[model samples]
Structure formats: C-alpha cells, structure tokens
Target: CPALGDVFCIAQCYRAEKSRTRRHLAEYTHVDAECPFISYDDLLDRIEDLIVDVVDRVLKHREAHLLDEVNPTFKQPKKPFKRMNYSDGVEWLKAHGIKNEETGKFYEFGEDIPELPGRKLSDKSSKLVILMLPPIISPTPGINTSTLMIREVIFDRCEKKERILPIR
Candidate 1:
C-alpha cells in the first residue's frame, strides 16, 4: 500500500491536473516528481516536512479566527454530537423505516437481521437470493477465492436496498 504521503501526492497530482495553468504549473510538476522517486527514507523526510508545513499553516489560519488570544471560539457546532451504542443506533434506524424482523430491534436498511422474530435464516447463512449477486467462487479461474468472497460481500451489502427478498 502507498503511504499517506504517496496518497497525498497522488491527490495533489490530480488537483494539479484539474487546475492546470501557467501559474500552478511548477507546483504540479513538483508533485509529479515527488510521486515515483519516493524511496523509504526520502518518503519519510518528505512526509515529515509536509506534516510540519501543514501544521504551521493550520495554526496560522486558526490564529486569525480566534476571538481571544488564549482560545479560539468554534464557528459552528460539530455534527454527530456523540456516538450511540449499537442497539440505540439500531432503534434510530427502525424509527427511520428500516424494519427489524423482531418488534423492537431495528436493523439498518439491508442489514440481515437473523435474530428477529420472523427471520428464519441463520446469521451465518450464505445463500444467494439476488441474481446479480456475484458468485462466491468466481467464474474466472486464478482470481483469489478470498478476494472474490470479499467482493461478493461488498457488492451484496452495497446493493442491499435493491436486493429482492420474499418478505419485501
């Protein structure tokens, strides 16, 4: 996997590509050069410098937004005030139209609720109900089985709302 710096470099490259102009040309070129030649030690140094520069710029910008010298006042309330437990979150989900097979327990839209009252499928059930559901064992040979399983799970989870079920 590429390191954080590499990812940042790639993003910077993309932005540079989008905003290609004479003034920004040098900055984009630097980012491109920074991408491929990143040896382990070079990457570490570049990442450290990047972190320091980012911190310095953030501190400077935030200082300008401070109401008092000692502390800065927040501009707006942060979203998602606090995290809720799984059960509480599930209850909220149920309130919002996701039906739990059981009366009180609420499962998210597409989340399989095997523990619910009317649910007959086991929690570990792997039966494919959706036709578009990719096979666990890939038709293409040589591709990793584990990779295929992961892909299948992701595809199913992503398409859960669209999946046709007997109850639905």
Candidate 2:
C-alpha cells in the first residue's frame, strides 16, 4: 500500500470502563490518527496541530457559541504545548509531596499516574499548562496494561477556568 500522509478517525466509540473519571466516557466520539513512517516526535506534533486546528475552525464557526456557553472564558491554546518526561514528572510529584493512594509511599519512577493523582499534580502546577509523560511498560503480574497518561483541564481557583492539556 502506498503511504498516506496522515489519516484520522473521529468515530463514536464505546468502552465498558468501571471507573468513574472525567476523562472516561461510556460512549463518546474518539479521535485517533495514523501516519505512516512518522517518528514519535512527529506524531506528537501532528496531534497538537490537529487539536489546535480543530479548535480554531470551531471557534470561527457558529458552534463556538455553544462552546462559549459551556465554557464562557474558554480560549484557544497557544502553540508548542509544554512537555515533561516520565522520570522528571515523578520527581516533580515527589517534590510536591504527592503520595500514591494505593501505596502510602511517594510516587517513584515507573509508577503509573492514575487520573485522580494526575489531576492532583496538575492542580499544583501553573494553570493552563500541558504535561506529557512517557509511557510505562511493566512486567509484573496484574500490572501489564500500558496506561496512557492523563490530560487534565483544570478550572483554577476563583472560578476561573484554567486548563492542562497533556498529550502523549
């Protein structure tokens, strides 16, 4: 098959997830893309571009009024989203005294940052910052799943909406 520059799918997807998290939905429109011969960095860049482009188009159309109603002060994110490595993020969490809920110990390297815990960490960072963490590969029993990190959008204090856009 000849290579295609970039292909994306935005479809109605369903998942039977047991946990209740803001990031989880029983059925939602899932947006995914595939690009042949692209490096990981290229993939990240493409994803950021797609998101920003979509938001820009929406804001330019009448749908933006609907968006504004939901988030009145919502604004299009600037380019070059902030990024962080997995090890560095773990250190940041430890430095801020965030402990794992399952194990009372501090979050260490190779530890999975679940949605709730990730939100807690995002709460401590600057408002509207994007945090990207590397994927975790585990060989232990009952922990073999590769969990993609969280993308938190936090509404900061004083009822002002601040967002954290994490992409990995």
Candidate 3:
C-alpha cells in the first residue's frame, strides 16, 4: 500500500530542493563564491545520477519487504498484477490526470518514477515507487542506515494509501 499524500509530499520536497540548489548556484555565480570548480553541466549530471540512485535504492528496499506495516484505514484493496507495458502506465497516469511538466506528458511520478522505458511500477500490482530522500548534510552520514530508515518510512506511508483512491 502506498500513501498518495506522503508520496506527493516527497515529490514536492525533491522539487523544492532542486530549485533551491539552482538558486544557490545562480547566487554563487553572481557573488563569485568559491563554490567548488564543478561546471553547471557537471552539477546537473550529478543531480540526475543522485536522483536515479535514490530511486533505485528505495525501490529495492520496498521490494524486500523492509517497510513498516501500515495501519488499515479507508484504503482500497490492492489490485492484482496486470503486467502492463511501459506506455500503458503513462497512459494510465494521463487518464488519471497526472501530467508531467517537463515533457508536457502525464506519466511523470517525480522522484518516485524511475527512468524505466516501460513497465511502470504501480501499486496496482503490489509494485511500489520509492523515492529516496537527499542527504541531510554535506557528506551525508550513514548512507546505508539512513536510506533503509527512509525506505521504511516511505513504505509505511504508502501502505496506508494502497487503495484509498481509484486509478483511472
């Protein structure tokens, strides 16, 4: 079960962080701060890679059943596995009114949706999309432990909303 609210919150946080980073870069450029020697392209590339890694770790953790048990609420029952094609998932999101701002498409799941070609992970098939949180501080500490804990938190949040709303 995936809680939509939590997922949405994580997505928002990721976007905000990205925005802040870009703003900081612009400020540094103006002030000529010795903000390292990384090029803008390099920074962007690193961010992309970091996002992918986080998503992968979260997905694996969820798949391993490491999440906490969620309290049953007004959640809808999980749907059976459908083995849908990648395009199908995108279409489904579009049908459900989820739009991607980048491609002007509706399949984007922010940090949760991986860059998979097809076969979108969905709660319908007991497949969850995990989005890892960025490191708390520079030189993030306890990478493994923190990631696992975050995964558990995300899992519990999602489980609570497994079937709360109908998917289009």
Candidate 4:
C-alpha cells in the first residue's frame, strides 16, 4: 500500500449536466479533499474540523462584511457533527411524511432521494447532515472495499446528507 494523507484542492468547476442538490453548481468554487487509510469516523472528524475552521476564519477575516450585510442571521455550525445510518434516516423521513414527488409515497429503501425530497428532509431535520457507510468486509480475499452500491439512507444536519439516496 502507498503512504496515506489528506489532500485538498479548490477550483472553479462546472458540470455539463444539472444537479438538484444545492451543493452542486454550474459555476462554483469546489473544495475537495481525499484521504486514504482512515476510518470513516476519522474522516468525518477531519471534515467537520476543516469546515468549522474554514467558516470561522472566513467570517472573521474574509466575508464577514458581505455576510453581515446580506444574511446577518447566518451562524457557523457547531462541532462534532451527528451521525446516523441509512435505515434510520428513511424511517425518520417516513415518520415525518416526506414523500417522493413522482410516486407521492414516503421514501423507502432502494429508492433514490431526489433533490427536492432531500431538501425537504433537510428543512425538517437538524442543521448538518452526514451519511456514512460502515467499513465493508470484502467477499474476495486480499481487499476490503465499501463501494457506494449498498442502498442505505441517513439524514443529518450537514450537506453530505444528499447522499442518503440510493445510486439508482
């Protein structure tokens, strides 16, 4: 295995196709990071820390004036973001009466949560949302991998919650 560390990049990007999630943009600055050899929890912790640090710093030195003028009520998210598995998220959505636009039915496992439903879920839940797939035990020998093939749903207070939908 190769040495592992986190790498980050910021760039102006655009996709040919449209995306429903607010996190996506036709033209936006993308903040990306990659880290190998870390557990999902560790990665989450790192991401949380980075977001808090960046937001705080930006508000303090960079965009405070603009933010104050435009949206003074905006507040930085608190640390230690919450975690929930996919099944529970689906239950929460169902209990809350969130439904798919096409089917007009409450979301179920294996159904893709489109942008509207995802936004509805976020509007109802806590501020930050993060969905994490637990480590996978490989069926084949000599490798352990957790591809995003599993159908699970998890909702939380952060932007990562969009992934709660299955990859249909």
User: Highest lDDT: which candidate?
Assistant: 4
**Can you tell me which runs of candidate 4 are displaced by over 4 Å?**
20-22, 69-72, 114-127, 134-168
Worst 10 residues of 2 by lDDT: 153-162
Clashes of 3: 8
RMSD for each model, in Å, please?
Answer: 16.8, 9.3, 18.4, 7.0
- Write model 3 residue lDDT over 31-75, tens digit each, in one string: 111224455335334434544565457546745343324322222
> Measured by TM-score, how close is model 1 to the native structure?
0.22
> Comparing 1 and 4 by lDDT, which wins?
4
Model 4, global lDDT: 0.58
lDDT of each: 0.35, 0.58, 0.34, 0.58
Tens digits of per-residue lDDT, candidate 4, 1-168, equal 235466778898788887766656778887776665666577678777877797789778954799777667665777666566555667778888888778888877656555665556555555655554422234533233333333322231221323532111
For model 2, how does the per-residue alpha-carbon lDDT over 1-168 read when each residue is reduced to its tens digit?
126667777899888778576676788997666565666557566656767898789888976789867778565666675555555667888888888988999987656677666766555554334444443243432232333323222221111111234322
Q: Point out the higher-scoring one by TM-score: 3 or 4.
A: 4
Ranking by lDDT: 4, 2, 1, 3
TM-score for each prediction?
Answer: 0.22, 0.65, 0.22, 0.66
Residue 78, candidate 1: alpha-carbon lDDT = 21
lDDT-superior candidate, 2 or 3: 2
Q: Which one wins by TM-score: 1 or 2?
A: 2
